[model samples]
Target: MMKKTDGEKNKFSLWLLAWPIFIEQFLQFLLGSVDTLMVSKISDNAVAVVGFSNQLFNALMTLFATVASGAGIVIAQKIGSRKDEEARTVAIIAFKVTTWIGVFLSILLIAIPAPIATMLQMPEELLPLAKIYISIVGGGMILTAMMSVLGTAIRNTGNTKGPMMIAVGMNIVHIILNYCFIFGAFGFPQWGLTGVAISTVTSRLLATVVLFLMFLGTFERKMGMKDFSIFDRKLFKEILTIGWPLGVNSGSWVFSQLAIFSFLAILGSSELAARTYMSTLESFCFLLGFSLALAAQIQIAHLYGAGKIKEAYKAVYRVLAIGLPLVIVNAFILVLFGGNVLSLFTKDQEILTICASLLWMNLLLQPGKMINMALGNSLNAVGDTRYTMIVSLIFMWLIATGCSYLYGVHLGWGIIAIYACMIVDEYIRGVLSFVRWRGRKYLRMKETELERESTKFTESFASPSM
Candidate 1:
């Protein structure tokens, strides 16, 4: 059913891999909307707290994601190399390490939620909710991290359906639980923001458990006690090599979001709510692009790790062709109905006014973000991560952050101004990504002496790096 190359382009199979990812992400994006809708009903403060805590939550996840990214790369490489037993070993190590990391990080996250929130300038009235929010979510952080490790492994091996199905089910669980806990339905105590957090954790735990079991049952490269043997220092090192850069890249760049969100909070609760709603809505439109990018990374990694350089390049181009058109359409919708979409979030007149203007920028942002995200992830998949690190620091930190500050805080242009700056930055970074991909910089870098062997492919198939 899943062919190595259909018509030498393999476009259909590639899209098949990508589409399930789209469903998975779309489902996940819906959960973000769920948070905004449920919390916004509570208060703008509730919305801000959810957004704020989530940024920190993403930050915490990056720790595990970094290592999981490495594990995924290893899985790709090993599978491409036909080193099935080794891939299983790498998966076991990755999951165990991630689980332990999650446990430790959860402690720190719970202990210092307030201090972090304070540094982000949480309003006094909102601080308590933020604390509760972080605590509940943080308790389940390990489950989230474990899921990423296992999920990435599954995706690396070309099994996309389970994850998407799990997500659809999880989102439904999340929403049902959200209603029960948030409103204190069916004898449940009303916990408001904290209830949302509880639902989130519970859902994640369910997903992680299911995926873990699937890992054992589905794969030829099964996880057993051998992979978890702590004495296997070499396996851990291999996972770290692929994972660290990804972790740092994700961590360093995403922290910029944290900074931006903090700035929004300072603008007032209404503005924060608007920004939160905008982000949630934007997720739906961009998720297809994100799914394509993820698929590209997996496919490219498989090819490159198998030494199929030409195929890797060809695969990425196909990914762009399919993903770009979708982005354009999604962005156009945002441009056309920005106001109406803003209306869905709130009735606050002040927020509606600010968000309405901000929606236009989503047109520019959607495409640009898609470009950079595709290029960046594809490059990283092939182990050319240094380029992403340098590029992200320049654009995400220097340009995006600078313009945001100049417009939002320094120039007093408000939230719209901040978003305008964000759109500009996205455009710049997106163009950079396109240029790099077209020039084949990442491909050449992957072909370099030290790493070229990491990517290998052939007629039947190829193994991605492990």
Candidate 2:
């Protein structure tokens, strides 16, 4: 009974961290859905253009996301080990470093918008609109970067609700601004895609500023600019060491998804548009699994840092058991109302039918996906990122994209076939990740790395050699 009580307490803690993240992600999705639905009003081509542009932006951010992931892992573990100052230092360095990266990226993308559009293989008709959208949003990449880092930092400190509230407020402003600008409502000029871009950038900038203030006021660690100033070269290197593999993992998935998109592009705009719509619906399922996984990752990192490997192992199981069924339920609901959901995006009957069929396939696909997501998150937190990264690269490039090309394009099996290959990839990698976590290898690796960090931290203080 005591054991069961403790399990329930841990489960409550997991949801405490997770629910806010889920709300934030859901709002973010609604922001995008609003943009897509509004864009669809102008033209299906418009929707496709924005979809491709957003993907490009996300892929580009994958580089900076590495820093965020690295910081989160290091900070979470450091805090767990009762090293509050060290965790604060990691947060500041991450903010400073990723902010600069975001500035450079903003300038680069805005300067060469055409090349970005070309790289994405934008349809000829969609190229101009895509360029316009990218050019505007590209300039605000710094705010987006800062917001992401701040959100991660705060969440690591176990204050997920702060970021979630900020997101809710920001997305509300975004929708209102989009409505006014996109349609020329309330005497605003109808700027179309330009308006959508403006709304996105403005909202993110606002969110970033508010989140920064909240970070300063709310976190128990109480960081200062000085904490960010003493750049520990060793710690920075450690961050990169943890971060790059995670970055590669993100980049691999981005490129593979793009490859599949390219295949869909060959089928024409309607199909691509249908895919964009279907993917938005699918994101709800992704959010359910991913939010829980993130919470699990943080809890596992804390347990490992505190030398509770057995508890960490149990935590992963608990996360998986909870997350997987939620995803299955989310998929089931999507299948039930997918047709009605597709109608929100467009009136094309054929596209609607294709999207509905894909929703049915999701009932099978999402459980495997949830398993992969949950375990992958847990592995990365434990400093076992390399295994997950390598597995992702191998399966994504070789099995997922390779078969996507062969079956989706060459054999003309259409988008469903591409999705089938994707499900195959998820299950394969998911099983491997689960197996790795089931063994003692990941726990051993975590122990070694944490011990090294603790030693280095102690020596640095003992000698004061700077």
- The numbered model that scores best in TM-score is 2
lDDT of each: 0.78, 0.84
Candidate 1, residues 1-466, lDDT tens digits: the string is: 2454443234325777788998888877877676578777788778878877788788778888888999898888776656777777788878788889999988887788888788878777788888888887887888888888888888888788988898788888989888988888999889887788888899888988888888885557455655566435787788887778788888876788888887787777877778777888788677888888888888787777666788888776776777788988987887787678667667889888877776777777787788778887777877767767777778878777778887788878778777877777777877776677678775676568435333343422543432
Alpha-carbon runs more than 4 Å astray in model 1:
1-12, 230-232, 439-466
List the lowest-lDDT window of 10 residues for candidate 1. Answer: 457-466
**TM-score of candidate 2 versus the correct structure, residues matched by position:** 0.92
* RMSD list, candidates in order: 5.0, 4.8
Clashes of each: 23, 0
The CA-based lDDT of model 1 is what?
A: 0.78
What 10-residue stretch in candidate 2 is worst by lDDT?
A: 4-13
TM-score of each: 0.90, 0.92
